[model samples]
Target: MKRIVIIGGGPAGYEAALVAAQLRADVTVIEADGAGGACVLSDCVPSKTFIASSEVVTGYRDTEEFGIHSDGLEAVTVDATAVHERVKRLALAQSADVHSKLVKAGVTFVAGTARLGEDTLGHTHRVVVSPHGSDSEYAIEASIVLIATGATPRVLASAVPDGERVLTWRQVYDLPELPQRLIVIGSGVTGAEFASAYLAMGVPVTLVSSRDRVMPHEDPDAATAIEQVFRARGMTILNNSRAEAVTRVGDGVEVRLSDGRTVTGSHALIAVGSVPNTDGLGLTEYGVTVADSGFVPVDRVSRTNVPGIYAAGDCTGVLPLASVAAMQGRIAMWHALGEAVVPLRLRTVAANVFTDPELATVGVSQNEVDDGRVPARQVMLPLAGNARAKMADLHDGFVKLFCRPASGQIIGGVVVAPRASELIMPITVAVENHMTVSQLAHTITIYPSLSGSIAEAARQLMWHDEE
Candidate 1:
């Protein structure tokens, strides 16, 4: 039986270990922290739970427009403490669920630091083991090893996370009370989502972005819509502003920008980026090549240069998403177990940023086509024109489709609407199956639903204005 060892208990590692165990391989998973990784305990689950609370409050605010509310607006009070309590409870419950699965699958669970041990085949094939508690360090001989150590929030030299005044995304859950003036730095997906959520919760928000607009990696039109909505909600958005330092003042925090401007807030959240947890793994000693950013270099099959050693998830420098990580882990095990498996394909990958009105996309982006990499024509249908969007009181959103100019083959698409993250699945399927724009246009989507706009966008592309 092949002994397969997985490092880190994130979705990637746990999922891979389960697969290896089911294949009858002796699988062992070594994780320093608890199972479920940061995705569940800190990042994805916790944040989404908080957003759910904020979304409920936002619905109440919209009741006046629907003529469904009469009075009691002055008596409404937000109980952030209660919301946070539920978030923590849900996160812990899910982590326990993951722990149960690993045990039932017959995978050995070890809690401690893991590293490379004895190596063979020119330091390619190696032993991976770790020390647990005070007991003597145990060693596990692995015919194959999978590294799925995920990432942590990136820290700036200018502003360190204090878990109080200055906070990281991980520490935001520990806040005792909502900040009267919350300042969020970085305009990426994490930043925008939190800022939007807090604003919906009735907290005054100030978004500090070094770029010209928020969600710079997304479609420009979508970004503009988000910015407009934020401004309309009384959010103070500071663009082209770079934060130089963050210091805690009396009862709050102050942020100083490079332009010699200073802004004070009750709290500051640094949603900059993430750094892969790759240090001290003894990777180089095992002939594993690492990138400049300390990420392990792996092929499409999740194989490292070192034989019998593989890496997946954020550690492999792949797209940083829980869904992608799970897929990568399965692919790695399939290849390592000598089963038929296809290489990883980024072209068919779908990603979503869970901001208000969301932003979801699959396959290629318009920027790629503009750079002449993928030849395609595009068409956009505004949500304002959709009957469902009108019924749902949505005025700002759109569905844009990219297709081959002559053949009308759907290459990629973007959707910006409420729960666009869930709505993008059909577009992902269309891209994966290589469906045409006309095919999407013909697909029956329920009327008076936001998904219908996807079909309408394809219809617009089918009957384009000729030159």
Candidate 2:
């Protein structure tokens, strides 16, 4: 049996372990955190759970518009502590579920920090695991080593998290009470998500954007819509402002901007970005190439320069989505174990920003088209034109499709609506299979549905082709 060792137990690590084990390979997963890593135990699961609570509050507040009147609406309030308690409970349970799967797959689980080392012969790879809260160290020699150590939230020196007033994305769940006025720095996905959730929960939120607009990486149309929604909900957006420092003031925190201005709030969340957890792993010593930012360099097949040492997930500096991480992990295992595998195609990967009226995208983006990287025809159908959206009181987004002008093949698409995450799947499939716009238009879609907008967008593209 081929022995495989996976470092880190996040989506990438755990998924790789299970795949390797099922292939009848001896698999071991060494993780410093608990099983499920930051995605499940800290970042993704916790934040989504918190967002769910905010979503419930938003639904209740919108009930009157739906012709439902209830006396409880006026008195409804979020218990920050209780909400966090549920978040923690759900995260732990999900972690336990991943652990259970790993156990059932006959994969050895070790709670420890892992480092790369050479075997006694100095020819094969070996992992030295230093167990958490203990000094006992053990080494596991393996034919293949997969690095999936994931990443941690990047923090500025001036905005150090105190776990009380100033916070990182991971530290938010531990709060004892909700902030009366919350300031979220950085207008990327993480920053926008928290700002939206808190605003929906009735917390006064100020979003500080270093760029001129929020989510600078997203399509301009989608970003504009989200910004409009945010401002419409009483959110104070500081555009073209950069946060220089965060300091405690009496009962709140003051964020000093680069332009000689300051914004004070009861608490501040630093959602700048993330740093990959690839340091101190002896990667350089093992002849593995690591980028200056501490992310491992890997190819499409998830292989590092050092043969038999593959890296996946956030540590590899690929797209940081959990789904992409899992795919990379599986591809790494399949390649290493001599199984049939396909190299990762990033264009087909779908991503979602979990805010109110989520923004989901797949295939080519509008920026790509504008930059002349992707020559395509584009069409957008407003959700307001959809019967279901009108009935559901949802009218903040659209479905945009990008297709090859000559052949009408669907190349990419974006969905900006409630549950855009789900709506983008069909578009993603169409892009993946190189399906034509006509095919998508012909696909049966329920009338009066958001997906109908997708079909409508495709039909619009078909009309453009005819013209």
Candidate 3:
């Protein structure tokens, strides 16, 4: 039987190990940070758990419009301690569940960090495994090696994370109490989502963006809508402002900007970006190509230049998403086992930013069309006209579709609304199946539903293009 060693027990490593075990291979996973990596134990799962609470608060705040009223009731106070406890417990529970699954699949779980070394059979890899807090290293042999090591929040010396007054994305969950005022630096997805979440939780928030607007990566209209909503909620927004450094003030924190502007807040959350965890992994010695930003270079099949060595997840730098990592893992296993496998097709993947009015997108964008890469026409439908949005008081979102000008084939789409991730599936399906906008327009969506707006947008696009 073939022996396989997978490093980093994130979604990629765990899922790949499961597939290898099913194929009757002896599989072992070496993970230093336990199961689920940052996605479950720290980033995605725990953060979403807190966001779920924000959804409840938002629902309660908007309940009065539905003719429901508590005569003298006020906004329910948030217990940060309780929230932290639940977040940690749920993360632990999910991690335990993953561990159980690995056991059931007969995959060996090694609690350690793994580095690739010499190959035993030109195909067999020697892995140096060092357990956390231990000086000893164990060498293991594997016919195939997969690297699923993920990324970490980038830290700058000017604004180091003290895990107290200044915090990284993961450390914020450990806060004992809500900050009197929280200043978030960076207006990207991570920054915007956290700012929106805290604002929804009734915390005073100031979003500092160096760009001209928030969510600069998203659609212009979508970004505008989010900015308007954040402003309307009494959240302070500072744009065209770059933080020079974050220093601890007497009892709070002060962020000094490059333009001689200073802002004070009880706490500061850094969301600039993430650095791929690639160092000290022995990749350089093995001639593994790395990108300028230090991400491992791999082919679509997740194979490195060296034979029998594979890399996946954030380390590959394809897309820093848990779902993408899981898929890459499975694809690596399939290709390794000589089974039919398809290369990673990022254009068909759907991604979402889970803020109040979520922003989700799939495939290409209009910007690509304007760049003369993809010839496409666009159509957008405002949610304000949708009956469902009217009932739900959702007036600040839209669905936009991009399609081939002549073929009418759906190429990509973006949906900005509540649960936009779930709503984006139809567009994902259309893009994957090459369904035309006219065909999508014919599909029946329930009346008085936000989903209807999606179809309507496609219909409007079809009409305008007359394709």
State TM-scores per candidate: 0.96, 0.98, 0.96
For residues 273-295, could you state the per-residue lDDT of candidate 1 as single tens digits? 89999888889876789889988
Candidate 2's TM-score reads: 0.98
Clashing pairs in 2: none
Q: After superposition, how far is residue 37 of candidate 3 from its true place, in Å?
A: 1.2
Native-vs-model 2 lDDT? 0.92
TM-score order of candidates, top first: 2, 3, 1
Q: What lDDT does candidate 2 reach at residue 13?
A: 97
lDDT of 2 at 269: 98
lDDT of each model, Cα atoms only? 0.87, 0.92, 0.89
lDDT tens digits by residue: candidate 2, 358-440:
99999999999999998999998888889999999886999999999899999999899988899999999999999999999
Model 2 segments more than 4 A misplaced: 71-74, 119-123
Top candidate when judged by TM-score against the true structure: 2
Best candidate, lDDT? 2
TM-score winner between 1 and 2, please give it: 2
lDDT of 2 at 421: 92
